[model samples]
Target: MKEMTGLVNTKNKNKLPGDGVVGKTCNNVCNNKTFIYTRKSALTLLKTAGILLLVLVLLAAFTACVSRSNQEVGDTGTGTGTESSSGTGRETGGDQGDVQGAGSKDAGEFPLTVTDANGVEVKIEKKPQKIVSLTLSTDEMLLSLVDKGRIAAVSYLSVDPGQSNVAEEVKDLQKTGLEVESLIAMQPDLIIVADWSDQNAIKQLRDAKITVYALKTPSSINQVKDAVMTVAQLVGEKGKGQEIIQWMDGKLKAVEEKVKTLEDNQKLRVLSYNNFFCTHGIGTTFDDITKHAGVINLAAEQGMVMWQEISKEKIVELNPDAIFLPAWSYEGFDAEEFAGSLKNDKSLAGINAIKNNRVFCLPEAHLGTTSQNIVLGVEDMARAVYPGLFE
Candidate 1:
């Protein structure tokens, strides 16, 4: 495990006037008012009345000044005042200043209550300044919805080029495993984890009174969009989350338009396979990708459910029109080499994908993505299946 570092340092420069100060000032004004009202004799009473009026005017003016000063201090402290249309706020510190400002806008009322993927309602008292993401999907979404400085840490997979879309963006951020102690040390205001994260770890964090939001594992494009919106809402960036969804919709719309031109006969039967003979099936994001790309998924058609392993004979029998392999290597298993082996296997020569040379190595970052970047997977499959359509 990498040592936890890069935690954001937030320093509030301006302090609001304390209640004691205001209380003392009010006490002085009231004491003078009482003294003036107690004056005896007609002339003294008239003079005291005039002084009383002046004192009241000064007190009101002083109270208004204090109120305005307190408001300014609050606005400066939260970095939410005078937000620009670009969604940025006053710089707070180094690179984090811009990021802090970006996330401060469009934040709906605090003391927010929402249910998590686990069906547990969690309440947030204020906008979270320090956030930690335990899932790669949430890691990707957070980078887009908030400032990088606001993120205390992300998952270890987020820095892996083969498995993450925002690997480069999160290189400088701290990485964490499921260690409860490390998360506690970060002092995060909120922690985002996948529904599949270890229940024991989550329990421990919750026991420590940390705010942990468990997001459902997105198995389809629509589910992915929902996760994005949920994360944005959790972090007070719903507008940015909507913008990301729109961007995804816009790209998907273009792909759908192009795919509409393909006739039923022209649509290719595609299969995504890994070295372990594991392939995605119905109810998986890959299945959703195939549907949107206008391609027939061989695994779904063969009555497969989630990720399942099949024998080599099944691949031969399915005889997909195009086979999508991952463009990544892990645990000594190389996808490019697997693709080569598939092409050279004489026993599999009868397969259409092999004979037609339609075997492709799609980026695992996109193919396995559960974020807005899943549209890239859709476009990759669509373009690979019908090269001429994209051209």
Candidate 2:
């Protein structure tokens, strides 16, 4: 995020002390020993006294104005008295004193600016009343952070129970397409997209004068939290974001505490396998999940990065203790059938997972989630790998 700058000057004009005071002196005198008080001199003295009194009043007003300005700036800039659910001081926004529009006092500061995943400095003029989500991840975060009435539309995937955790909640909401014309028709005040979204589409949206924020896809749990917080800040739901993170933390902490009881030899070697022979490796969220679940990811242990396909020969050689499959099925793929095939494969029969019937199908929503729900994936994997300990 880029640092915000500039000061907010609430008052239109301010005058310094003695700014308009006219300087005058009395000239009449009776003698050197004693000053004589003529009517003219007395009038001049009275005028001088009046000017001094006015100056004093102006000075006091100026001081009060300065103090008030300082307090306002401090309140907005310092994020004072605000802390995350974890008991850490929260940074509201850096130098947001320059913001110029109305914002919900309870939600967040607005007329806010932030650097998006694309490294562009995007400025939001005010709290968005109509928001559009272009990706399932953003869709998930939006549902949890803001009211449904504030959302104009969400991605089509948001209605697919197989792919979305909040499918039921968002089923009644409008599902949007990626077409520029459809997006423009919605007249959204803000549009949130993933980094992988069509750049040409994003450009078209911006060219049409729509506010769009592109978020980076998270590859790890920490990155997921960052994405969640970023969305929360954009939507004036920082507190809600913190709450989601705290919930994730609490769940993960419980799993960690239980995993601590496992000895080194008790930890299992696990592999996340999809129907396509694809597996998540190092630098992927699955790798982080495996680590937290007290299991070794065979793909990551072999120095793989991101999603990649492994050869059947390699799978046989690696011989994982347990295998995880996606719980959801797509158009042509069936998860249960895939698990059955894995169990019946003659070559893979020697594999420990197959022989021991340790093949598990985890919910696709939890396994591939980029939201706070990913913690559920961690807990699921932990339970599947060490059912005895978890029970």
Candidate 3:
């Protein structure tokens, strides 16, 4: 029966056996003040346990919500967060991995795929942040394209004068040759080599799962632009490469136009020779440059890639109108002074090129590097041969 004044019956005799009860002595806590005291100390323990259980459940629910939020961020690669949870001993559906920052292309973007000049399929992982250059020429090209800080290592000879331009920038990276240990230690995202010549090195790097690419080095001008463009396409900088090519094409067209105006009587005969009096043979890049400059290359009779002694009589007989000698520093040869000596020699006095005072010094920076330097060489040759149109 209900108590008078609408109070709850506090007598344990009226309560269920399983209903563990505790009460404060205060009348406010129970129907009668005389029925209980001291918070019904023993029964209070039961309610304390129940209160703790409720709090733990709420905490677990909150943690699960937080973990789900992090999972959303991980999928989007946006917030790049980590989440941990503990509840009911059975957890599911949490993203696990390191957070990859958004690349220049897009967030979670990776694996730039391409087919190289060699017609082999290639793939790059994780937007290469660090690069190691294997050739001296790649070292020069890297100087113009990416930041110096992005270069991890370069070939030893790249720092020498007349070979590389970014010597000061790559001082530390030149400490060791392109050894696998040294290259891997730099943590480079990619390694660029001239060709497949480093098969052993490539195998070692691939065993360790490092990405490497073989860049092309063309023997002639026709292949030069194509090689440079190939590298640009691989690195997602094709737009920049095409722009440079367009500029080169326009420059070449300008030179060709100038040559078109020259009369047959005005065709200059140019003999392009390497150091130690070695001539650039048939189908050399100099042939294209000289032909564009309205000059005839005298070395067309020789074989491809190199030339043997063509006899002093043949040189005198051809009598090129100008001797276009490349300035190079080799064993005991001062490129500039040597070219001057060749021009002033008593034996060469009768040669048409020597008599006409048409000796030219080509920049060593041009022919020494890679395909990119070939463009520079062509420009230099064009300007040196015909300065009026170039200026």
Candidate 4:
């Protein structure tokens, strides 16, 4: 091969005019013998032809490679790769089928089987025309990712403007409970229930052959983002899931950049207070929100976990740098009066937060959320804790 390649290179050089290679070779051949000149010329022609053939082969191979790449990109539409589903030669697009996210994928066209948070595989033969959401989190997620007309019902809590972020949007939808009877009557094409939902209800729904997927409560921001993607995947709206994730990512990045000036020691100690006189602690979504907002959760530090109730004395002892109260607590009452009462409360009067008037009423929907909208909660808290940074 090496010898042949060298010969091809020599012939190529001889073909170029003014190289003197061909002239020198022809002179040597003519001086030796006239008969040998014809033979040398024939050999030179064969070498030149071989080089041309190799060049054509290389060009053809390159062209073929480029064409294949273009064809793949064109066929897939999304440059991401496709995977073949089991037994079906039909191509099921993976991350490439939809916008990229934690939960976006084309699980194949119809009779799609999706594995839920519980690792249970649920199959859907067609696009769900009617869907029922059993939790406020699912209500908001479904509303954001799916058409309103397809929603057969939402959790009763979703109708209360104070409890749901999409309360206004869900008001027209049927308000229902997770009772087996109600769910059976709705005849939902798909039912979304929480991991904490009643096992009996889930059993009844499954017994009826209704497609029900249980969504796990997201304890962290990443899990929350994944939840959004999961719901989007179940509803066959992976693109919407990606959009939700992107929106959350943008807000999170903005909050992160805005808080760069604040040192770790500068983070404000914060606590979330609810109507039940409890505070959010470790393993709760509120803790995730405070951490993302560049604040330390006081309750979590005090060894509280998962909505633990604290006495008034503990409130003074912890004396968070800032107190976040749900805005819905002001319902049927004056906001100014509510804020003033907390400010003047004898027990909390000595607290630094109350003394400095740093108590803020966070939106009910934003504070209690465990979905993509939790980004809104993080943003609200960040702005409240560090107003100067936002400005």
Best by the TM-score measure: 2
Model 2, 33-113: lDDT tens digits are: 100011121221223445777979866876776676666654543333232311123343322111211232333667665
Q: What would the per-residue lDDT of candidate 1 be over residues 217-335, giving only the tens digit for each residue?
A: 88888778777766776787667666777767876898899989888988899887877789889989999999999999999998999999977799999988888776767677756
lDDT of 3 by residue, 1-391 (tens): 2211111113211110101112111112211100011112232222344577797986687677667665654555333321111011112211111112232222124544443334444567655667777877666555444555666777776666544444555666654465888777776778877664467877788677777776656666555565555444344444545554565576567567776877877776667665655677665666666665666677863444545455567778778777766554555766656665676678889987676566666555553344454555555555555566544
Model 1 worst lDDT run, 10 consecutive residues: 14-23
lDDT of 4 by residue, 3-73 (tens): 11211223122110011111111111212100011112222222344577797986687677667666654
lDDT of 1 at 39: 18
Q: In candidate 3, which residue pairs get closer than 3 Å at backbone N, Cα or C atoms, i.e. clash?
A: none
**What TM-score does each of the candidates earn?**
0.72, 0.75, 0.64, 0.69
Better by lDDT, candidate 4 or 1? 1
Clashes of each: 0, 0, 0, 0
lDDT of 4 at 41: 20
TM-score of 1: 0.72
- Stretches of candidate 1 off by over 4 Å are 1-107
